[model samples]
Target: MEKTFTEEQRNFKELAIEFARRELNPGSRERERRGEFSEAGWQKCAAFGIPGITMPQEYGGLGLDTMTCIATMEGLGYACRDSGLIFSLNSHIWTCESPINKFGSESQKRKYLPGLISGSLKGGHAMTEPDAGSDAFSMRCRAEKKGSHYVLNGSKTFITNAPIADLLLVFAVTDKGKGFAGVSAFIVERGFPGFSTGSALEMMGLKTCPLGEVFLQDCEVPEENRLGQEGAGAAIFNSEMEWERSCLFAAHLGAMEKILESCIAYARERRQFGKAIGKNQSVSHKIADMKVRIELSRLMLHKVAGLKGAGKRAPLESAMAKLFISESYVQIATDALQIHGAYGYSAEYEFERNLRDAIAGKIYSGTSEIQRNIIATFLGL
Candidate 1:
């Protein structure tokens, strides 16, 4: 299906593309190598109102709908080489900010949304624990009511932006006997007593995106800090997941197109057996497949965005999009690597890095296996 974007949305995409080329493309490799999170780059994005695109204007945001946000993110991925940075930004927006915007009380929005939108305050979502990777709701973290506050005691690992986040939306058990419904969400700030970040994790890719553990020992959050009701964490988390699964990959579809272009360029220039690699059917076919995947993935993403913008539930669509695009990304990266042959295997080209980053897509934001399960359940399995 052909999708049409508004003039304002087109302008948003153009602005994001320009900003990405100027700010994110040049130093992406070096930043990844040094494991450096670019405060300067983030500030540039903030100045462009990237952090506020989907937020309300009253809260210092652009209040763009879902489609505009996806368009902007796609432009960023097309022009930017920093996948790690894009991933981190998506995590902050969908997982942290969107939840607050959707579920937080009016006072909570007033207290946190502005800084979050302006990039003055960074946010992270803490849900995964050491024992609860794919089965994320199987958490051991506990929060007990004490007076007017909830005393939290738990540890969450594999948390994105944990080391540098100013605010955290965390999930813990308020009633352990209630299984998944027992989980509750809280908004915790940095420097809260007994809240500390663990060591930074060394990841295969996305090095510039800091991942760490959050330890909450007797951390006190007032009743007002609670995101929703005591048993609303699962609902809130599922909503965020729908947003994250659908939108986080918008950038990736752009990257897939970029990779395709790069591979085609290499195939035409690099000669083998007295002819360019493009002359070979294998090389041409790989490029063809890449183009097909890019087009299909883009369509799926647009569908999800449209559904979300129309205030419709999109669990099946989100899962399908996430499953297909993530696996397609891995395949595209692999084909790009193969087209480059030995150069793709080396650090001299970005293909290797793209391959490494693609591996994580299949794992995080719900794994391919988990997505399949979700799809099956939707089919009434």
Candidate 2:
């Protein structure tokens, strides 16, 4: 992996690690305990150029490649204890910013990208309805075209950043007869008439990220706000998912490395009986497994990044990477907790928090089961 990056990319990773330790690490524990969303932290990340890593320079971004984005995210994950902050940042980048950058009209790009990239405007997307999670194409939300505008109706649950988002790329059915092709996406502002957000929903992890519900009841959207052509929602969605599976999971690889290092340190310093616990085959082997997971996760994640950087579609590779990295993080977290014994289970240490966060990795950005199904379909099974 060392040879995989240019000197500039490696420098970006190192800079991100140092910046995260200095800026995002403070008060993270207290913020998580209170489920607080840190506007200050968000701005700090924006100021540090996180939100704009992969965006165009004209849009106030760094205009870097996908590998740099992944590397920077990995560095942030390794150094920053605020997993929820990083989670929210990933959601903002992959789902909202990347979509508009890819598919939005020039006017739309001129309108939204600057604020989004600068973190002056929080953004996300509304796609997963209460009934449409894994079967996301089966969404019931409808958008009826009326003259120069469209009126949107339906609700989205488990929407990341909904409670505090400035805008969302909302998906809704425009033609029931067309199945997945019937759907269209709209760049809906939070203040759009008849659009309201539910209070933030509490979760087992990523609490500070502010997950919630979005309700669009006859919500009026200008025709100009429509993203791409009508019925392009499915394509837009798949594109974003590929990006999410590739880039969002890079943070998990970083977190796994961090946890493995912690466990190794604990195993070496803490003694059992007459020797360090690391001397025991049982403890040492568990640590060894962690190292293997981190290496494998890095390889798979970098493969997806390399593919995307080359302007290639990687549905199969992204699925495999997401599934493997997410599951690996969960297993690694579990092992770290066990290795630390009571300290891992207790809140005094961050291991317990890491475990909670890792479990969510398996569920989001396409669940592990969903990824396996995608892979099987790709194999012609």
- lDDT (Cα atoms) of all candidates against the true structure: 0.90, 0.92
TM-score of 2: 0.99
* Residues forming the 10-long window of minimal summed lDDT in candidate 2: 1-10
Query: Clashes per prediction?
Result: 0, 0
Q: Can you write out model 2's per-residue Cα lDDT over 71-172, one digit (the tens) per residue?
A: 898898888888999999999998999999999999999999999999999999899999899999899999999999999999999999999999999999
Cα deviation of 328 in candidate 2 (Å)? 0.3
Estimated TM-score for each candidate: 0.97, 0.99
lDDT (Cα, 0-100) at 96 in candidate 1: 92
Error of 2 at 122 (Å): 0.7
Lowest summed lDDT window (length 10), candidate 1: 1-10
> Per-residue lDDT of 142-204 in model 1, one digit per residue for the tens?
999999999999899999999989989999999989998999999999888889998789999
lDDT of 1: 0.90
